[model samples]
Target chain A: MPAALHALKDFSDIHINLVGNQALIEAELASKSFDKNRLSITHAEQVVDMDELPSKALRNKRQSSMRLAVNLVKDDVAQACVSAGNTGALMAISKFVLKTIPGIDRPAICTSMPTMKGHVHVLDLGANVGSEGESLAQFAVMGSVLAKAIDGNPKPRIGLLNIGEEEIKGHQRIKDANSLLKLIDINYIGYVEGDDIYKGNVDVVSCDGFDGNIALKASEGVAKMIGFYLKAAFNRNLFTKFIGLLSYPVLKAFKEKVDPRRYNGASFLGLRKIVIKSHGGADAFSFFHAIAEARLEVQKNVPALIAQEVATLLTPQVIEATHNEI
Target chain B: MPAALHALKDFSDIHINLVGNQALIEAELASKSFDKNRLSITHAEQVVDMDELPSKALRNKRQSSMRLAVNLVKDDVAQACVSAGNTGALMAISKFVLKTIPGIDRPAICTSMPTMKGHVHVLDLGANVGSEGESLAQFAVMGSVLAKAIDGNPKPRIGLLNIGEEEIKGHQRIKDANSLLKLIDINYIGYVEGDDIYKGNVDVVSCDGFDGNIALKASEGVAKMIGFYLKAAFNRNLFTKFIGLLSYPVLKAFKEKVDPRRYNGASFLGLRKIVIKSHGGADAFSFFHAIAEARLEVQKNVPALIAQEVATLLTPQVIEATHNEI
Candidate 1:
């Protein structure tokens, strides 16, 4: 928190409103110097425990820190909200407070996946499991619009994530979604397998939350495993230790480029307002990255862009085409 | 092919039967030196294409090399079989030919997940997607039996792969499977997440084929991505390039330890006979690893062990308990 606050000093135009227990936040800020006008705090009555069920949290913690932060976005006091809270609870409150964008059926979690070329957007990473064809199509368009708005890449190559790339492969939902996508305006590549996520060829990868969540987390697990093995290998003997010392700079550069913190923000796309989710276990550096990401989305007006794209998506031509294809 | 053949020379007691197009197999083996008496070949009329649909290949290609290899095992000429072919076709034909072990409901694809401690077995990588609760429980028993037999752990720690560790966290399939696991005699440690697959604390991680396939492929993608970044970083400048040269040995050792080839074989468990599924794109070294893995499973009689454990798992008391819990 201190690191994030200190780094915010350079962003002269951005104002931050901290919502939490008033005294604790104030005490943490006491030792730091800042532009007092740019910093403010809102008192919240409680904090939602990470393990609490989303329904229970929604019913019991109306004045909780998470809810209060989201309310700022709702009241237009803030253009965007950022939370590193319980994902389900945060998602529930964000959807309840801000609602979905016009023509959007459900909000999807979209995050940047680091790849060889750069990064591509993937969704919905645990927001909606066992999703139907219609919902998945919505995610594809929402993700495509996000890429256009945020990455300035129009006609992003959108792919349906599947077990195989063949036309007849995968369960019915993907095949149904494939038919719907072909009728839409977005650049719909038929299907891509898991390895395509990092290939940098496809710009958007869409799948149900069950597969998406596992793909995201499993990728992280493998990265960490490789890092551990690399470290262990380098520490084996005096010669290897010397080699590690010599290669420290190269390794550090490599780590920075691939670090998850560089891609900290996960957008709750399809919502009326932008809500960026920082990893729950994120540090001050990662939180700062999340704020920076949220700032970018605000500048681009991502929600309005999605709402506009979806309006076009629902026009008679595309809708009739979708109907015919389905 | 040459490397695997060279490695097989030391294991002289084990004979090798190359099954494929006669001309192609002979041409490839002409330059390789092995004990001629120990090597033989079986000519097949057709080869199953990698992209062919499983049902199509099963129906159209009766004399395909895949069918002939499995036929050898059925004819008692071989104790086990290995294939680096289309997984769907392989599973379909293997099930058609060998059938499932008594007390086993279905065959699962089990592969070793490289972890910090060494490796742990993860099951149903892509065999039975959208599995029921009963099948999931059966996977647990079969996986535990294989772990005990192959890894020599009397009581292998088995966990249901899930998005969360909490009892109420995942879908009903996982919750139902959790209840069934508790009632069964396996060492069921409740739920584990994607990271737990690499944690090395648990010996067996069980999941439906959907999540399991994504997780496995996603992990591989991450490793490849990291390797790419590492190479790019080291080649950025002369100083880093020099460091890269110095660190080459250390890096090679690290890569060897974490290489997917070291953990290549995937077992099609629950079949009456041992059948290993090598990664379709695996090279000679990786195919050798698959053959080596098959040898271990054959020595352990993994299927019979699964049948015996499942015999206990299906006892009237356990079956009644399972019925009541779900």
Candidate 2:
């Protein structure tokens, strides 16, 4: 509640509809000073637990805070919605309330990753586990559109994530998707290995949710492991600890440069409405970034842009040709 | 050649047969001091290029250095073989020359990755692209045996890499493999996500070649990205540069703790004979580590151990039941 109020104070142009227990939200907000006109509370009767199954939440919790937030978007009461709730439940509720955009088979979870040059957007972090070649092509198109809409890259270079760069490598589905992407109107670059994600040469990378989830989690694992090792190395002895203290400025600079909080929002692309899924454990600073991301998507009108692009590119002939080629 | 000679100098018990042009080997070795009794040269009429197709190398390059090295192992002239050549060609040649162990479906590329605790062995790095449930079960068995033989862990916790920890998540093949692994005699833990790879909770992780390759390369990518950011941060200004200089010893300690060169070799497990593949761009130090890895495998008799375990656990009823369940 404090994070949301903090975000409300920072973004002067936007209004927030905090959906939960009105009394509890009022109690939390009593000490904080903010513009009363810029914030509203919608009383929701239920809340989704972090570990609750998506199906059970969807069926049982019709008045959930997550559901009410998505309903606000659906009813045009809000331009966008950002949640730091259970990912599965949020995805289920958002998909159910907002539905998918025209010509998109499903919504993909897309997020920006820090890269050497700047940052790159990757999709299908863990939405649908085993997507077909056509679904992969859809992910590529959606990722490309989101990249262009958010980054203002007129022609963002798109790459298919694969085991190898060789055309002969990877599964048959990947090869089929590669063929389909080449036929599409988007700027589809050839295959890219996992290492290429951080090189920043490609603006967007698309893959099955299974592979994408693994890649993202593996990257997180490595980052955390490195952090752990750095701490251990610095705390080895008094001399090293003194050196670490002296080097604090440089380390701080590096941490700020690659801070995950700065890149907190993950857009649910291919949906009819703009929805951002913040990291579940986000603090006020990180949650503020997620709200900023939502405001950006609202300004850009990302869903309308994606709908326009998909209508123009996904012709029946092109889809048939890709399926036939596979 | 120098790296090989350096390794020969370090390990007094191992003999190395320099398989290539004998005249060129002698020219490279003339300036280096090494014991004469520990080194021999075998002239090969052909060489495998870095980009050469594995099939072409196997079909045409009968007298290639890679082939000769594997042949020496097959003939018992050498206990184990190590090569810093093309991965595909090396796997193809090694499998062709040594063949698969009984009850082992295919050979997997297995390597150790640095973790928070120490390191964990991960298999199917890039040997096969799309593996079935049975093949994944086979990989688990082989990886478990290699971990036990090398790490001396009586019961290594084996994890199957998947998108989620839920029983119903991930591809059918993965779920099928999970069921089969539970029926096997190894220490079969439930599904683990990608971040678990570096958590040091599991001793071995088994996945298909495609997912494994992506996870490994993504890890390399993150490490390199972090290193690049650290360099950039330290070089930002004159004051930071001075601090970086003062912190050199601490930084070096962290780098050595997670040095890729220290974890150079990838074993071709399930092969009839032990084969180690070094990174193609390896320097003398890194290549020496690869040689040391091969020596360790030879000492542990990895292949024979894998064969024995596979024979004991992979009963016909278990295989048939897994296939039927899938």
Candidate 3:
């Protein structure tokens, strides 16, 4: 609430709708200062438990904060919605209420990753499990459209994440997807191994949700381990601790550069309306980043752009031509 | 050549058989110092390209240096073999020459990863691509055996890598493998996510080669990205540069803690004989780590231990009983 109120104060042109349980939110809101006309709270009857199954959430919790939040977008009261709720539940409710873009088969969970060059967006980060060639092809189109729309990259390099870069490597599904990618309208880089995601040469890296999720989580884990190691080393002894104190500003700057909060929001790509999923464990700063991302999504109109691109690219004729070229 | 020669000197009690093209190696070795008795050279007719297909190496490069090195182990002239050559060719040739442990299905690339508590061993790190439930189950058993033999952990906490911790989560294969893991005679922790690998809660994390390879490489990429970010931050201005210099010792200590070299030396586990794989890009310190790993393998007799475990664990009756339990 503090971070959102702070950010909302700065984003004077943008208004906020605090949608959640009414009594709980009103009690919390009483102590906060805001532009009365700019911010308002809406009542929600229920909360989505972090561990609740998506099916249960979808079936029973129709008036959940998650669902109500999405409903705001659907009802044209909001351009976008951001939540640090359960992913499966958020995905289910968002898909159920907002629906997917016309040509999009299934939505993909994409987030920005800080890389050596600058950054790259990776998609299907555990959104569509067991992606086949067609869905993967859709993911590519959605990712390409996203890169073009959000980053303003006219010709973004899109790569398929795989075990090995060789066409002969990986499983049948990826191989089929590879052939399809080669014949696509986008600048499809053949195939990228894991390191390529951080190399920052490509604009978007797409993979099966399972692989993408593992890679994303593994990267986070490794970064966390590095931080832990650095802290331990800095506090080892008096001399090191002195050095650490002297270098505190530089260390803080470095930490800020790689903080996960900067890349906090993940787009639920393929949704007809913009919906962002924040990390479940996000703090005030991170959640503000999520809000900033939602603001970016509305500014960019990423979903509408994807729908426009997919209309031309996802036709039966175009798919057939791609197959014939392969 | 310099790195090898430098590392060779430090490994005084351990002998190294340098196998490569006769003239090139001879010219390179002339200036390097070593304990003459502990170092020897063997000429091989061919070298494996980094891109050479494993099949081509196996069929046509019979006298390749890679083959010659493995042959030394087969002929009992060496206790173990260490190669920083092409992984596929090394795996193919080693499997052909030494074969697998009696009850082992295939050899897996197992390596230790630095974690919060200490380090944990992860297996099928690009060795067994697209593994089935049975193969994954076997990988668990092999990993369990490795921890007991190599680390002297009486019972290791072995976990199957998955997108989520719930048994009801992940794909069918992982779910099937989980049931099998439970029935087996090892400390099989239920599904562990990517972050769990670094939490140091589990001693062994087993995954399909595709996911395992991605997780491994993604971790490396993230670490590299962090280093890049740190360097970029430290070099941003004069004040930051001064701080970086003052903190040099502590920074160096931090670097050493997570240095890739310290975690080098992946074991080609499941082979009948011990075969260690140095990273293809390994330097003196890293290659030496691989040599140290080989020494440890010889001391622990990892393959023999795994064979014994598999003997009791993989009998038809036992497998059938496990299937029945599942």
Candidate 4:
């Protein structure tokens, strides 16, 4: 809130969508004591319950905070919408409001997951489960664009998540999708194993949301579990404690470096507008970082670039098919 | 060789089909200094190549090491077979040599992977990549039995791996398998997440080999990558070094506790004869451990128990009703 307020301090054409209790939102804004003329705060009448039944949260969208945020983007009150609420609901409203870009089938929530080597961006982790072949191909395209915009790579090497490195691997749907991606001239690196997710061998990792979510959760749970055991082991004996003393700097460096909070922003690619889905458990700092990402994405015109690329890639195929069909 | 020879010296009438190079087998037997009458070492003309094509490894009727191992069990030349070669080949040979246990459609491989919390015994890691409804149900039944016999669970809780936890969740195959498991009252635990494998939340985690292999590799890769970074970090600076010093003993204890050597045996579960498939990269110790497990399973008559239980479970349903017909 402070960062947004500060950014709008000298601007006359800025407003904020404070999606929560009316009085609380106003009071929080008042406490900030920024240029009142430059900023306007609109309290959202309803907020989606952030819970396991994330899909249900969007049902009461008439007064939902997420709906209001989408409305701001739709109404041109804001160039981009940002939310740290229920991701499912945010994706829901974004689809309903902003709509997918032309030549794009479905929008993908793309996030850069940090690896030991560096970073790898994976799409559709929580946005869409049980993806169709066409949609997966679309995710690959959007993920490549996102990586490029982030300066991770000019044409990020894209990998389809599979059990093996063989061409004839993966589920039937993924197999069909592999053929579709081959038609495009993208930098498509073939099948990648789960180990590749962290090995940093590929920049863009794409999979159905079900597997992606499972992979992300499994990775996170294992890390936490390892930390727990490591902590327990450190307290085992005096001799080991002495050894740990010698290794203290290394362990501390690792913990600080691998912290998830360092990369809190997740971009919803392939939308007509740029939207960043922040972590549900994000703090003020993370929320600010997400907002910052939304600003950069909007500035970079990532959606427009993706739209252009998708059209270029698909138009020829579509035209050839139309000719062949005729 | 030494341990078996020592046992042979103490307990008479142990027959050994010593396959591979005659000189090496003779030297090993001679070094053990066992009574010549107690240890009968018959040299086999051939050994199974680890890199042989699966067809050659699987279909070769010649006395290939793998085939010889299976033949020993089949012909009562040896009580069981233990091999630390190609797993796919072992599964194939086990099936071809021993035949499937009555009422079991396909063979499943059960391996115990050390999770962050405790141990998770996972099934069908590679044996059956594309399992059918009946095959999965059979796997569930067999896994439950193995858990009870080996892991010492009175009634092992079995979970079907799926995209969701609800009974109504998952693809058609899982739904059919779930219905079958429920009908038989096989201690079914509905569905489980990928992380559940490491969280030790489920006793037996069953999945198609594709996802199972991916999940296993993902866990292994993440732990290793983090360990690598942590080591690098420990050497970075001084203050972090203090934290590492504080945490050494507990981590070492944790590492020792989860080392794969403790649970190195993987059983090819649907065969009529006992076949323990050791890791291809296993050393002499792991191979010997696999042998011990195979011996135990043979002595306990696990295959017979599985066949009996599975037959009892399926008897209630019409034998004429096929999966496709359903």
User: DockQ of each model against the real complex?
Assistant: 0.58, 0.70, 0.63, 0.40
What is candidate 2's CA lDDT for residue B181?
95
Residue A37 lDDT, candidate 1, scale 0-100: 88
Candidate 1 per-residue lDDT, tens place, A1-326, comes to 56457546957778889999999998988988888888889899999999988888888999999999999999999998888998889888998999998777789888997998999899988888778777888899899988988888968999998876233367778777888888888899978888889989999999987778888888888888899999999999999999988888899999988999889989999999989999989888888888988889889998998889888875667656766777
Q: Candidate 1 — which residues are off by over 4 angstroms? A: A165-168, A315-326, B165-168, B315-320
Q: Which tens-of-lDDT digit does each residue in B1-326 have in candidate 2? A: 77788888788889988899999888988888888898999999999998888898899999999999999999999999999998999889999999999998899999999999989999899888778888888999988998898888999999999976242388888888999999888899889899999999999999999999999999999999999999999999999999888888888999998999999999999999999999999998999999999999999988888888888899898898877776
Ranking by DockQ: 2, 3, 1, 4
Question: Mind giving the per-residue lDDT tens digits that candidate 2 earns over A192-260?
Answer: 999999998999999888889999999999999998898888899999999889888889999987888
Better of 2 and 4 by DockQ: 2
- TM per candidate: 0.96, 0.98, 0.96, 0.85
lDDT of 4 by residue, B1-326 (tens): 65455445544544555555667777666655656665555556766676665667665636676777678789977777777776766777778878998888788888887665567678877666567767788888888888788768897888887754222145577667766766676788887777677777678877777667667667766777777777777545675555555555555577776566667789888888888887777766566667667766876788988988888887645333444345
Q: lDDT of each model, Cα atoms only?
A: 0.85, 0.89, 0.85, 0.73
Off by over 4 Å in 3: A165-168, A322-326, B1-13, B165-168, B322-326
Candidate 1, residue A326: CA error in Å? 4.2
Q: If you assessed candidate 3 against the hidden native complex, which CAPRI class would it receive? A: medium
Least accurate stretch of 10 residues (summed lDDT) in model 3 chain B? B164-173
Model 3 residue A167 lDDT? 23
Interface Cα RMSD of candidate 3: 2.0
